[model samples]
Target: MEKGTKFRIIKGIGLAALVAALVQTGRPSLAQQQPADSTETKQDVIRVETNEVMIDVVARDKKGRPVRDLRPGEIEVYEDGVKQNVTAFQLIEADSAVASSSEAKSESTVAGGTVREAPRPLNSLRQIKLVTLVFDTLGVESRRLAQQGALDFIKTQLPPNTYVAVFKVGNRLHVLQQFTNDRKFLEKAVERATTASHPQSEDLSDKIRKSLEELRQMGAAVGAAGSFAPPGTPGLVSSGAIKSGPPIMSGDGSVAMEKPDPVRLKLIEVTLNALRFTEDTQRASQGMSSMFSLLSLIRAQGDLAGRKTVIYFAEGIQVPPSLNELFRTTISEANRAGVSVYGVDARGLDSARTMRSSRDMLVAAVNASKSQLEKGSDVALSREEVMSTDTAESSLRKNEQGALEDLSISTGGFLTANTNDLRKGMGRIGSDLGSYYALSYTPQAQTYDGRFRQLTVKLSRPGINVQTRTGYFAVPPTAGAPLLPYEMPMLAAFNRHAPGKDFEYHVAALRFGASTNGVRHQLLMEVPLKNFTFTPDAPKKIYRAQFSLMALVKDKDGRAVQRLSENFPLEGPLEKLETSKNRNVFFTRSVTLPPGRYTLETIAFDRATGKGSVRRQELVVAPVN
Candidate 1:
């Protein structure tokens, strides 16, 4: 079959399967219901979902220099004015995890290979969480210049192997890039954020005017040229009148050879396309509306529950008016996903000097135009009318500033004023990100009653102000358990490998599986040699493969109970098949009860080349009645 036909068949089948899955999930065709408390159980049991918390502490003196010597006990935590115990504490160091050079290559081989080396357990005992950088660039006049400093800061300051995602927020939020350690890719994405006409900006009018002017110039030049006679004529135009014929003349002695200039037409087309792009971007920038993008990114990163930092960049945030409720919902979602947002005020570095100067010039031009119009009309402006107009203009400027301040405060990020030393401000931001501390604690209550809980983190040492998320949304009790049972199968499908003629195929799929019975899940994954076929006559082939699988299970008190390792082999031909499976069960099994959350992780490694892949999942099991 042709590739086109094959693709169509595959696409149709995929669409049908997706529709069936949606129906099976009992979700509406047009809209799916939000995850709610299960009504099947009669007992009103609230399950609290445990989330990894990563705090970014900014310690500065009267003059802004980072103070990094603070200890764990010097910090205090409060939830809505109620003090909570700090269950975990740690000081993150540079050598937290050892890096392997050939890890990627080892994991890609078909032969079962040991991919990931075991992570050396840290002495410090702080709960780790995923951090995302939300970068907002809406208010910035030059995105390219501003993004450079921001990208440099992140690349140089963030810890190695940190799960980071980058987003640009303006009139709309755009996920410019997803979580990855590839420094080059991140830099390229940042540099690509050039200043374009945005939906909310007044500069669009100038763009439109330029487009119109170009179009007019083309029209005039085409008109000045007489009807085309020879092919090599300077102003000769293509006559689109005929389907397939030479230039045709009209009855009025005019040749039907007049056509719009291709260059101008192309320009107009590009301008129109840009306008549409701006509109789509505007819609995406709405706060919380772009959560799905973040969710998808998290899914791609496997389990985000065990990450050190998340950096957020954005220009402005327009959260819902019911901010308190919205905050709870957003926080709850982030907690369940094991992620926290560290908003990098992308707009903060932009100096207002250029924009202020431009505005002043524009104002002067407008006033001069008004004065000329009045003089030419031989009419005098009324004093009251003139005063009213001035008042209105002043109000508009004030409103713009107020809007910027509101956005900065609502998202737990600071607003940087337009200053001469823009790069200096960015450098300070980088230092703050690099030197911050992280803190995590479990709440006394396990129930999320849809109530707003205020969070306060204070340093025992005076003269230090800790900036963190104001609070998080409380999770409903019943919604804490794993809802889908096919998570493993789905993961396997995603990582399945197909073998060709000369090379053997090896695939390792990993996911943190939740267990309520304390009877730990012993996943025995096997890849039969017979399932893969290869040419025997192709040079003497030695397909040696090794891979490792690591699983870590932690209980409510943030203590690791079960840490397991398994190695597997991949080799042999179709007939003489070699199969490998690794399984380990936890002996000290205790069923999860109310008031605790558990984290599970699985890492697949190739022993041959020392490459590996990782997956993480969280499970919250409530107590049995």
Candidate 2:
């Protein structure tokens, strides 16, 4: 397609598709209209909930080193101000947490399979813990530092029982190395991460730049208000305000005040502000999808018992406050899934302070505007405009990095920031995970009403700092916003790509012999338990888990012809759980159709982590005699 044609299509379809994706995914509808009466507007509350919560507690000494010596008896747990019994407890070694890398390395040396499609024999959780190392080449300035960090981690810090996989996140997330113990394989993965094949972060664009540009455009439009004229007034209208007056657009996306009446100036300013808000809202809304993708990757490890950690290395991307709620929701899901996130600020020492001043940006914009003056354009800078520039510049990174730190702290991992020594940060992580206590509690309150619960873990001993998740959303197993009768999450997933880019799960469909009325399509939903974080609720020696499945069959017109939802509740003895987890969760689904074309969409979600795998397929039914 030609570039212009493609651009036109994107501009036309971006908003329509974006809204559909958000609504199908159960997010609040953006750009909802407000009643003309100011008093009629009311804010709708978003109720988020979760049942079980996992908090990773990291203890550190005065020198910021991991404190390995701490007992469950010395720790006290609380939720929403009430004390709760410590129901589950265990210790995880970075190297020996579940499976040490050393053991896996030795086994890789013995049996080698060059075939990537061949499935490796599943092993017990105690034999290995899965570590997925993601390289954020997009958000990081020092890709070399991040690469060395991973190499150093594999070469020096990999535990004997730990198996590490690699992924690179640039324009999109891609797998590098599958779970492997082989050091050489890991080093090669790290090397490939530094190549030019990685997408440039520049495509993401700078929000500060965008906001400043909006401000300049608004300023220019408002400055010309001096020549404001009324269209109906022959004297003023003849002055040419009507001729020069560009179309004014309203918040509701409707064109209003067609004539440039002096009275319309207020309406015009309101329209401009509304337009800016809508643009920002669109950008922020799209951010939620991106964040969900990252969280999905973090939770893709199936049936892997023990510690699941995603050390995300990024300078961080700024997300709007409206979207920050999604950030919290993703973290809450991670805590429930027993996933601990370690945020590695890839920028190391962020040194843009001197260059990122608002005044500097203002001066640059003024210079650019002067150059544009030759083209009959002008820029008006007001006190408010300067402050707006400053605010966007200074606060751009505050919450972005804060969100990263929130991910680390909530998951009982260290937020390593403000330093050039990536190796040292890796060392701290190694020491921390080497020896730690795993503890769980059944909250006194069992109600899963999607409310926030405060969590506090106090140490009996002094001079030792403890870290874990701050809180969790009390969401029930089936908690979610119901989609329209014709809509499902698969709609968004399939629209983006086939087989979904969110979670990691596999499914296969086989058509059974046709029946009289319709065909029986048997679907095998294969979910590897290792991809999920399993917490053994102690005292009973049972690890309970929940996996959800939803299938939708849409006709050629995209109408939902059939649908089904299944919630699989898994519980078994801890040791036996290992044997059972190695196997995939398989189930069959069927839908009957007449002679016609249709779309088959299936989604498997890890209930605890909120990660999902979506699969889409096209089906054809021939007429029967």
Candidate 3:
């Protein structure tokens, strides 16, 4: 009810099938409008801020039924282990399919020194359920199962207050529908999402199979070749290709070695190159594009009110090591926005193909070992040893699913994997979305130190369970949310009455073709390397520079529409340090905005020296032709 209030809701109900049907509510309209595809009349942007933090507590008894009658005195809130005073309390309940406005029960209790009744009606509290169904690229079989699972969930008839949106994640995040309770619109969106699988996505499995075959071929070539010489000598060659006798002594007492076959050497080189190509292909198959699309969705959801839930349906979310930072950022943003991601592995009842593949590879290895043994090669491997090895498929599957688990569980949600009955999983998720106890408190630590503040909710009663987010960063709230560390500087610069040109930098806002979503523009910031301070690590013989670049795009009315931020960690050999100072660092980011004129404020801060530069530029986005 207040500006800048931070709300934390406990994790939603248990697993169930996803993308269900919903009915309209008697509460205030929480349905969100879809983004305009074409340029039209301008609409002013409004933002609200709050200083209070709200936590949604779900207390259940031994029987797993919600404990609805708990009083504020019976509950204790702790932030960073310090007990906090409860400022406001309310119970938000999910309306039944046939329930009317009058039948819904909304209770409120605000306490300072004494508890008092709420002055506003239940609908004014804006206690509504918001869910977004994101369908990632899937294989043919997975698409079928996912579609059916979503359709079944929809037919179950969700709560009247539950509003749903549909999106498809591929090369980009495509919104099929905005927030709505209408079953027809949601159904149509799901249809399009299910049928709109990326063309290349279906070929992903084929590509992996081909890559594996290439790896097998390379492995065979390596096995066929005898012992390898050290570097600088001839590489792998056919067994016995070299002389089996001792080295011949020359007249000068030098040992002359037999030359290796040129054709064999060429084959080895080709195989090695193929091995490298296969490795790169597998890493690319880990779905970096999908991860970025998902990030875009979470960041955009930060602007919405209350806690949001994302039902992410994908065959599997494989996050490679290189994308670790991006994955963490995705989770961090979701936690900040109070979004719980429930990942549903669409590969229902995964076939035993993985196990079969492992078996086949092992068999080939055993045959090759037998051939080597027959040839009296000491390098031959034992069949028993190869058979004793664990199946790599099991470990690989666990690793592939680890990303999904971490992404979901870190944000107060769970992953449903290796299950054929997606309907059951969605049913649990649906129940979790039902309702919870809303508690508000003002944190005692007023300093926005950008550090994580641990949160724990304790109940005085026994045999009761409470579920909520683990913690939140101690950042001051703005626009109903907190500005991230990298974002804080950009906003500060935008709000300054006078620009501080601490250093020299060039910025360009280049406009591109217009699309349905908005006009595409590239924001580029260039700064001389000499503008930043570099610290030299004598032992490592490298120079390091730390800094960040950020920008804020504000409309004509002075309301911020978009904020971009990025950090640069520069390091180079000491020999190149001087040369680097003569070069410039360029940063670029693409953003889409409605066709209109706006002011772009940019900042470049050197973290090492704590020095920064601020600049302003005017940009215009022409409407679509």
Candidate 4:
């Protein structure tokens, strides 16, 4: 929680999916995404990408049984509210489907004297689904509980052949376990692992504090009387006295003391604001970037990977206002990758006092005083002040989980909340997974126009309930597509890049220490987000800058001991970023290796332009004495 503090994490190699992503460098050029079959002809050396939009449909009957017998005609597809032709439809489950497999109707016809599939695609008959369990270390209340719940579910509830990969998202994203059906290895991973943390959220006190402030503002806007008084006024927070309140808990469980305790309240407010900003900023930068990393992971998982469900367990996720695109982009990638996310509110059901703080009692005490004052004297309050006074527990729940639920719904995944027993939720999720189906469709008249597209799924039967992915970005077909920020070429897997000045950036610090795996090193890179070229039609006050980074630790043999890749997403006020350009916008990565001499290669690439900078630093991990 403090700046410059070193976080001990079990530093190790992440899931080896970046290599597969390397081959997908840039974007798809044409509809010819797949390689030419032996039965087909190589028309040109220039490859045209053949791709298909795959959607996983989870249909359930009125009684909640998995609807395993839905036919292709019974399902409908819509993107941006327009009907699309279902090119391929089939059921993908761990068990057999009640309905028969649909005929693999080849849309190809004789073209240029050779027969080819019109969609130019892979065999989209049906695919395999791998469940990805992602734990939010910083967001969840207890990491041990998350581990235990995950392990218990795996042992008792996980179906046979259901490959699962465990990931931890704390200060950074790390693959705790590779995708495997083996429960033994996974159980060990849950037990011995350390270092992975999830989204860092402020505690209950912070939420309550924020809510109190919001309610005050709302009350002021509503022109309420004797409620919350606005700041900069005669009585509230504008006092020259600057009194700090003692840390006393009142009846309502909020900071008790007197009104306009700006000194302490502001201190607490500032701290909470910092934490909130950090969480939102990380949500856009690291959280979404990690999701992009999974596109690469899908390659290692398997080519025909079916419903790649990432069961994301977190207390809550609040996307920064300016960074909503990051969430959208993350979900779009998931749609393209056919990955469904099952979001579990780790806070769970019950305990109405969850995330409560001094703000609660503070409000009641202030209001009680205000009520007596209003009865005795004429005291007018703003509408926002009144609204702030009335802000309730529901507001906190919505504030905490609204974004998370939207994300889950957008991805056509189930969001389990209102209860503490996630094991029961996990059972439901596992059962739903058993009955999920994959639907692929080609656009009849639509073109990849390099824009965002909204997708919707519908069922023909009334009593049946179906859930599937929401939408995807319409990336117009191109002759060549630029690589995503994190995509790395295989050749650069080793620390091959020498320190050079292709771009302007700074290395804030690099510290080395001992860890469970081996010697550990942390590298921090700082960049001025304002230096980025601003895209058109962005938020009025906010701007976005995108870049990709890769770090590699290579032994003296030129073998890469560990590799780190990050696609940095920056969003904030244009003015603040410009003014604070001299200040640090830091990015950190940790690597662990056996005591040895190694080359640490760091690369920063700007996606807006293909320009980048690479630095190779020599790091020696002395034998632990």
Candidate 5:
């Protein structure tokens, strides 16, 4: 019940009696692993020999027909001005692409007339087309159009062998649906996105418009008065401009006036409105949160093979000067994942409305400044404020539009804007996602200091346009080095207070005693067998299941000190498989750590159904007496 106290759930402990009966003899009753310290020296010496970078290129003829027959020799790939050897090349056709594991499974007749699932071949002719639909902040009309466009695309424009997933990014990221070819499920996800609400640009711009209107009204009121002082006049207000006859001495000896000068009042009002507009403009340009959420999503798909495209739907992403680097990072991450971002302006033809409002606001501020000057007022400060506000707002407007274009074009995708019919844009995206030439080459420099590496793809033939990512940031791939895409979910769960609800499991860590290697601890997990989904292996005459068990040990400072992961391939006689329902599975992993407080995080992931549960517990290693 205390904060930072790890909750220990000791369920299914009695199932230890059934472990021997369930596991085959001589294989250890349950999963066990040698101590991590024993292999630490060997793992520390491991280094990546060569890293291959993949690039997706879409080539089309002048008339817009795909030119897929181009050979590797005809295409030249350059990285940072250095031409590199093409290591891999593949032409992915829409109809030939196979994306999902379920769809890729093939059954073959084996001995005894039994059917066996053929192992998916490596480097096969068929590639995958993975597309993600991300819906961001939208107004009512734009949301409706986006929903309709998505529904139509799913119903008609969706190409064969393409897998689509739906996601919504608001204050945080929400996965509406995972990748699938089912049209009905995708449509249902679009329906769910219809009612999803976040901050709307329309509302933010409307507030700004009202402030500009107020400024204009104040300017008009000043212009209509002819008695105001001119630039050369001695005083800012004329002798009769002030309504008050003269200052009067009250009983308290405080000077009393009938009314304040209208010119001064109007000047103050104009300044406040200009300041409000500036503040609102800054607020409107904030989009770092959504960018971070998108980065997470893209990284999750880093290991996914084939062409991955993110069709991002929103009015436009606004990246202010402060967030420019973050925006670039988003593009770089997308390129690293081989994911293209196709930005669709949900406002369609009305996309320019914000810019128009910004221009109007600038005009109003400039006119107000001119009026202040004609009234013989000290307009130096106000004029500078107006000019700076106009410049900032204009820059923000340009950056908002530029964000969409840069994110798309930099990642080998295009932007769809200024059109009411969004479905046509979706159609183009489908065609673009379906057919592409994938190529990879090792960078000649091999330096990964996080610098942006410019990529140029040239063809020997003319009249053909090649579209690919501009380049990727020089960075090491960490997805499978020590951490994996599937492991990310568990790491996230380990950090958060909320436990995973996909299933229930128990985990505990016990420190035996101090040995020559410091301290030895055993990590144990007991999971119900019913949590896993078993598939009938016809050829093996048994039902088989597979799941990945991972343990992450972190020191008191929350830094991962050791990581252990292994896959469990379980199988049993088909008739006796029912007995697994009432039984539980146990796994043990040994970890050697120094005498310090640490946390052990574990996750049991069902590979068949894609379900997982993460549990954490605290372990304290005391010094020997």
Candidate 6:
């Protein structure tokens, strides 16, 4: 129990009662109050469809090295060019199943005769859904020694069922932490963001002298209270007194000058037009709306489509170049929602003397305030605006490494740099998320013309290198309706890792025990109902089934806390001559949970040949002691 002390006693007694039981049973208001013919008989029995394929494979090794092993029949898949047939094969194996379940319970109690009790072990490894951690602290000026090495590299390389979240842009974008897995509340939110510094030039000269004393007390309370006026204030006070009549003061004249209160000068001209929304423009618009609200809350928490992984961590910069089409439509909707984006440069773990003493204290405070405004003195910026703000901060550090290499090549994702060798870039992102491999197919262009299709994954034998996700978007057949096989396996379990599209109906498994109405929790599913097959002789047969289940209760650094979802019914029995012998079926549900670790997901469908399947599992619940 030392994976950081069972992730801090299961994240301090089950993450707030499993996030209040996953906001009371996994949302959609308890699957929209059941009936509607039980949600159209679970969307006329499942009909899942998902796509997100970007496996660039080239793991060389004729002596090339990157050949970590290569399986799934030595890999080979394609799409827009055709070739298919690799049904399903997941690799992702970074070892540590809690140190291989404590070395198989210490080699089974020293090979004794009574220490039995195995069961509880099935989260099938591969877990890393977007654990982003970018705390460059905008060139760290010691903010507690760069927040003690970014909270000791997020409490020593976070992992346990991982879900971590943190954002720090410096000069603005702060969320210090959010998608927690609670490494001591993300190490006290990186020690309360090491008292953030480095907005430099003396923190933008104390934010432009607190924006000119809050714009001169908001233009003297909008010139003595004219209720926030300003829609052509007499055409800006008749073009400033038709060029000069409002201020005639001479050598100690008793009436020196007073006409300036058009409602406290329009509340100091709208508080200096609301300090043009500063704080580094609200931390680059709250770090791009907290990275698209943590990718739309991990795609509305439906176990992020196919095999997901986000990892981000930044230092690279693309903040508002109109958010590059919202970061290429959020990495093309996280590659059609199968998510995958690994970047981690954190300014390549800085420290070239903390980036040359924070660029030599911002070029010696902009060359001593441009040599005191080129000698005229009272410097409020000029000397050609401090040499054009040091040439736009040297072109924003050379366009932040080409905007983190175009957001890690438009999201197929992979860019680990520096951070004192971020553990060899998180061990090459945990060996490319554990020897990556998951190929799917089935896109004979079947309508859904939403556009972008292109994909290619091939490897009949050359040096492997496929990294995945290049194109998707097809989606349209009137946006494929007629759902009910449990809403077509929860909408093809939200696109079971799309690409070519057949990755063994996206598998997800989990189970837990201790019944007697206490800590039960069972969520077993074996999707893969593909087009509802069965034909011995058929005459008037009509079978379409689908299913979807969700269960949550996370701790151990995975967050969530608790949730549950249901929508099953893949009915059977329709024969005129023969073909209804209950072709494998099973759906069960029970939840009592109180103790710990829980994450159960199931999505299945077979809407008369549309295809759908997904299964995920993880249950622990043991603790009533």
Candidate that would win on lDDT: 5
Q: Give model 6's TM-score versus the native structure.
A: 0.25
Please provide, for model 4 over 62-121, each residue's C-alpha lDDT reduced to its tens digit, 9 standing for 90 to 100.
887888776666667877787776766555556542224533443322211222222212
Model 6: per-residue lDDT, tens digit, 111-156? 1122222222433322433354445434443344445555665656
Q: Candidate 1 lDDT (Cα, whole model)?
A: 0.38
- Model 4, residue 511: distance off in Å is 20
For candidate 3, the per-residue lDDT at 192 reads 69
For residue 374, what is the lDDT in candidate 3? 53
Superposition error at 54 for model 4 (Å): 1.2
lDDT of each residue in 588-613, candidate 1, tens digit only: 11122233466554444343332234
The candidate scoring highest on TM-score is 3
CA lDDT of each prediction against the hidden true structure:
0.38, 0.51, 0.55, 0.49, 0.58, 0.40
> What is candidate 2's lDDT per residue for 395-436, written digit by digit as tens?
454545666787788767768777778788788776655765
**lDDT winner, 1 or 2:** 2
Candidate 1 ranges with C-alpha deviation above 4 Å: 1-58, 61-63, 95-120, 123-140, 154-158, 163-178, 195-313, 319-328, 331-413, 477-625
Model 1: how far residue 519 lies from native, Å = 42
lDDT ranking from best to worst? 5, 3, 2, 4, 6, 1
What is the alpha-carbon RMSD of candidate 3 to the true structure?
A: 27.0
* Residue 439 accuracy (lDDT) in model 3: 65
Identify the superior model by lDDT, candidate 3 or candidate 4. 3
Q: After superposition, which runs of candidate 5 have C-alpha atoms over 4 Å from their true positions?
A: 1-49, 98-126, 197-288, 357-397, 478-554, 557-625
Worst 10 residues of 6 by lDDT: 1-10
